[model samples]
Target: MDASELLEVLSPEGLRLLDSLPPWRASDDVVSSVAALRRQGHPPERVSAVLTQARLRARAEAKFGEFASRMLFTEAGLEQATRLNVAARHADRYRSAGLTSVADLGCGIGGDALAFAALDLDVLAVDRDEVTAAIASYNLSPWPSSRVRQGDAETADLTDVQGVFLDPARRTSGHSATKRIADPADWSPSLEVAFGYAERLPTGVKLGPGVDRDLLPRDAECQWISVDRDVVEAGVWFGPLARAGVGRSALVISASGAAELTAPADSEDVEVGDLGEWIYEPDGAVIRARLIGDLARSIDARTISRDIAWLSSDERVETPFAQGFRVLETLPLDERTLKRELRSRGIGRLEIKKRGVDVDPATFRKRLSLQGSGSATLVLTRVAGRHTALLCERA
Candidate 1:
């Protein structure tokens, strides 16, 4: 049986055999097998330790010196709760609000709860999984102020908490286990009810980055945060974030730098103008939060098209929220003879992009052999209902 299949069975004999094997000897066999699987086009991420106690050890190693428990490597995929980028952001919010006590509603493996406790904040870390809860307890063992408990979120008793952090279980299916809000009310009690709860104190609800913007409650101030150009989390502030009017801020964080972009709820819009020498692509969260106007004003740029998301600027603006690219050329729509023109220029590998077009990137790439050694960004989009191309280089 494959290692994962055997591990799934949790056989007594298999466990015994694995246990009897020496570490050095076992490592050789496991590494060789994993290499073969990888060569055969299988994802070797968590497959090797499927039937070994080393599975836990492997997880610990992947966590990079951080302790993690109740981490599940199920059919859906390896999901563990620990101090991730988003969790760290939430920890900052809690500290900023001067919250002394916090309730972590769906504390998976005590990642954020531990962060809260590390700050000397009294925290109740709750998880429904027994194995995960045990792991969380061990992970949070160093923190005396944090308590890890096992209970269903719907029925759990939460009281006297100065702030609440809810990252509800987004999995409802097997294997894929994609992000889904199966029951919106399970964690917050309800949309309106959750807002009411937030009105009382600082509440941070961790929603997937893909959540509909229209669903965001108007009463709660929203901040879309991106770490190192990657949109990590969108935080809602009820008590403090609201009072500060940092309403619609884009938090850009990196190892070398950090920036906070705050604008009014209805910031002035930049008028659409001709394409400039450079193009700036804003981070997803920044675009979704409609902070583009603020970014454009800061960079002295204008929109290429009101409908299109691309921003054009003549001056250089260094911000984590947007990637600036220098324009090589802009050509008119010529799909009928497009392949011939690209072939003549020795272009074979094309990275197709679309903003105001209905073309597929994969399909377009396959149809033409964009030959060239250097990297270039090709925009295959419709401007005025006609296909056009914009060859670009890094700015």
Candidate 2:
């Protein structure tokens, strides 16, 4: 939102109007809602501002859950905000460490700050964007111990806080249509300055999961987290916040709860072996943390190929860290032969999984000209050292 829209939305009328609107749905008529409000003599600008928030609140529900109803957000802020469940985990780090205060540098709409304050810790939430800081102050207003201010995160006074959480801006400054900042140096507060905070204070830095591993500090513990199978963020912890004897970790969180695989360092890849009765696909977080070897050992599995993340074992082993599939048969990698084989089995519905292959699944599937009602998963990958296709079923 721009300055004028922000001002309009912060008014009493705006809050009341936003709360009064029915819960937004994809099927709702947005144009009609705006027209109805405008007809009621609400100014066009106020109507637009309130409706925008209403839509944002709907989208925010996936991240903030019910708390999103009362919170304010900008498009960019909502996009980058941490999921409430994940933020609670972050807050637990400080609370578990016996730290009673934290400085959330570059806090975006106070997503993490909300968690910290909810845990009854004092919070200093700082943001360089004035509008975002104002929105954050509003979101964090319910917590008496939480303070929000507009300032440079790098220059923010840290004299009173016991721990620090930094989420540097990895995108250009804007409420919308912002481009990603590729260089860590171009990020707001920069990685160097963000990491430097660990020299004195217990610190946790949230970064994109795809960040270069070489840039990580040797003294810190790096943990990659995946929620519902989607790898979300990589958190680097320092000092007491860093877990003992854990250097690299993969944390997977889903409706089933959380599971973690950790090692003192990246585990050596297990030796490649011939295809087994079961094929397992390790979670993205596991692959990103380079703990695939550890996961394989846990399940008594081995890599299908030297560099491939896919694993296989003759015994059926189940683990949250990976999805196991029972091998159905081996099929020729040639397109025409595979098409004939699939059609013979009446396999019309297919789930295509690929690794260490160049063919696009979507394009390849169309070329097969599938028919019939049966369904199966087609895994196109390297077996031993050669490209192969494995027809499989979820185990």
Candidate 3:
């Protein structure tokens, strides 16, 4: 949102209107709500601003949960903001290290700063954008220990800060419709500057999960986190904030709970083997953290191919690190043969998964002309240097 929109949203009347509005829903009659508010003597701009906030709050629920209702967000800020649960873990690192003060440089809408403040740490949340900083201030208003300011993160006054959390703006500057910055140097607080903070104090840098691994520091502990099967962020920690004896780690958070796998460094790939009774798909976090080998070994499995992430085992093994599927049979990889085979099996509802294959599951499925009543998973992958299809069931 722009500065004017923000001003309208933050006004007492605007906040009251936002609070009074019913929970936002995709099916809600937005036009009617706008007309009603306009007829109630609310200015068009104020109504629009509050309604935008209501919509943003609805979208923010996935990241912030109930806290989102009371929080403010910009489209870009909400998109880049860390998940509340994940941010709590980041805050815990500082709390565990006995760090009482933290400077959250490039803090977008105070996602991590809220966690820090919630943990009672003295927080200085800074953002270069005035609108984002203002929104962050609003989100963090409940925490007296937290403060928000508009300033360049690269030049933020560290002063007596004990720890630093740097989330460099990875996108072009804007409250909405921003584009990703391809080069790290183009980032608002460049990677170089963000990493520089680690040299001076206990620091944690949050980057995209797909960030270049070669760019990571050898001395820092890099952790990849996935929430509900989606790989979210790669956090690199240095100094006391870095976990002991851990160079790479994957943290999987799901409804079940959080599980972590750590190693001193990337684990060596396991030897390739023939297709076994079961296939295991490692969590995205595990793959991103390059700990797939470790996960495979933990479950007494082996990779199906040299570079593919899929693993196989003779016996069924249950682990949070991976999803296990039982192989029912094998089918020819060719489209016509696969279609014939699937039709024979009466498979209709199909879940397609592939690795090291050129086929797009959606496009391939359409070509199959599926018309059966059964449901099955088709895993198209390379096995011992050959393309193969494994018909599977959830284990």
Candidate 4:
């Protein structure tokens, strides 16, 4: 639709007409209302558009839950994504980290903007679309100095902004799945451009959780964040470059219940090993930080290698840095013996985890007739060049 027509449809009177109806549903009532509106001569396209808009509002309302005030909503201050909580939590971190003001690049529907505003930070929320910008402004109206601007970040003025937040549009061609950063280098204004910008200020870039770590800049602080045990988004933190003595690692988790791991700063002299009496699986964030050595020391566990994420210890300790499982017995890679021994021990269902082995856990389980009564996590891994399995239980 043209801008004028779209604006007319979203005009004050139009919004009222849309809002006066009960919230949307797919049931008979909603269907009847749409049918009746059409029967009254409302164009089918307009009716369909209004229904879509109404349903979007209802969905946002549900997503914001009881904390709707913390979100940036549309003209009626409703409509939300279920991921708002995660955004809000990160916003808190931004504030606590001393970022007084922020520029939210690509502020989709303003989910993160609402969180930034909720923390009372001065925000310049920007989007390329006028409709979205208007919606953001309306959603952020409650906070002072929180304004939504329609623009592109590629050439926007950085001025004195202390931190910049970038959520590159992962989808292109009208929300179709596409490369998050078409030019991996230009991934969003190009990583080189982004790092240059970061040199001027602390920059936070949101990337897909599955992004390869090897592709990131050596100097950036990489973090993989998982909320409630489900990995959500991986981020890169870059500011002034640190001195050479400091290590390069990814943070796999947060202090407040996140799982992460780190790659070794120096890759040449690392070691690898099999599962032991105690198995420590680092958090996703920590693994990303490449700070596994720090974690290993903190937990008094030994690293199998700089690249491998698992930690081994004779003592099972409860630490957020890693998920510790008590090892029951160590066996060989022989499936027949492994299966028979597990079955004799009354093993019913098995949760298998493997590293550096080509064995398929599922096919292996079926081959051994592994279906009956017990629950356990079996580690099929190699340590010090030997294929061994460790049966474990949660510590």
Best by lDDT: 2
- Candidate 2: the clashing residue pairs are none
State the weakest 10-residue window (summed lDDT) of model 3.
329-338
Q: Model 2: how far is 343 from its true place, Å?
A: 1.7
Clashes of 3: 0
Candidate 2 lDDT, tens digit per residue, 155-267? 89999999999999999999888899999999998999999999989999999999999999989999999999999999999999999999999999999999999999999
- What is the C-alpha lDDT profile of model 1 across 15-107, one tens digit per residue? 443344343233457667557645755444333543333454355433323332223333222343432555666787788777788988777
For model 4, how does the per-residue alpha-carbon lDDT over 1-395 read when each residue is reduced to its tens digit?
23443454466655665666675665637678788988877776667656656665556654465454233244322311326666775576677777888888877667787788888888888877676677677677788778888888677766756678877654441221233344556554555665566767777777777777677777765656665445667666665322233344443334374443444363232245444578888766566555666777777677654345678987778877678888888788888888888888888888888877898888887887875688888888766666778788878
Candidate 4, which ten residues in sequence have the lowest lDDT sum? 73-82
Clashing pairs in 1: 70-132, 347-370, 347-371, 348-369, 348-370, 348-371, 349-370, 349-371
Please, what is the whole-model Cα lDDT of each candidate in the order they appear? Answer: 0.65, 0.94, 0.93, 0.66
What is residue 309's positional error in candidate 2, in angstroms? Answer: 0.2
Candidate topping TM-score: 3
Tens digit of lDDT per residue, candidate 3, span 1-395? Answer: 89999999999988999999888998989899899999999999999999999999999999999999999999989999999999999999999999999999999899999999999999999998899999999999999888988999888899979999999888888888988898999887889888998778999999999999999999999999999999999999999999899999999999999999999999999999878999999999999999988898889899998899999999999999999999998877998998888899899999999999999999999999997899999999998888999999999
TM agreement with the true structure for every prediction: 0.78, 0.98, 0.98, 0.72
Ordered by lDDT, highest first, the candidates read 2, 3, 4, 1
How much is 61 displaced in model 3, in angstroms?
1.0
